[model samples]
Target: MKKEELIPQYLQDELREINDIRPPYSFEEITKLKDLLDHTLKQEKQLEEAEAYGAIPKEEADITNLVLTVKHFVLQESIKDAIKQLENDIEEKKRELEELKRGN
Candidate 1:
């Protein structure tokens, strides 16, 4: 489950930023941003399952093997890219936020 499901997720230090932002969000824009965050969670769960099961190729799956390229790709590289996309969304939404304020 996303930690966001357990507790609200946002700028921890500026939570009022959350309350102040009202939404009549553009479905296209919000989905585009949310998809990035969702991808990371999906990848993480898949990585965990691969590790838990024997699905992982032995070389990348275990320390005694040659390298962990596949594991690193699934568990690290992809997740990092998703995270970066979400970070970018923070900046991308500034204009939308300004628009929201105008509605008030």
Candidate 2:
């Protein structure tokens, strides 16, 4: 299939897999997969309901990577937000410094 056709198909298959909340290999590894299992179930519940309303399924690859991506975002959302805030602060500081230099 063409790359354009393949990408959306891949994303859809991976998204559907979230509905299958398999147990992690180790309970101690809960930091990653465990949290995601809970979140995924919630997200999947919504997705399933949406599908019932009229959502169409798509395509996939290893699928594990897709799960991993979901887990990463769920785990790191706070960190990502903090990073964004810090970046904005840094940009503002730079602008202030430039204004100071211009006035000097």
- TM-score against truth, every candidate: 0.32, 0.31
Best by lDDT: 2
The local distance difference test score of each candidate is 0.47, 0.52
Q: Please list the residue runs of candidate 1 whose C-alpha ends up more than 4 Å from where it truly belongs after superposition.
A: 1-64, 102-104
Model 1, position 34, has a per-residue lDDT of 51
lDDT tens digits by residue: candidate 2, 7-40: 4554455445433433322333334344645665
For model 2, the superposed segments whose C-alpha errors exceed 4 Å read 1-73
- So what's the TM-score on candidate 1? 0.32
Q: For candidate 1, write residues 35-93 as lDDT tens digits.
A: 53355456556656887898876544343121223333333444455566667778789
Looking at model 1, residue 29 earns an lDDT score of 39
Clashing pairs in 2: 9-59
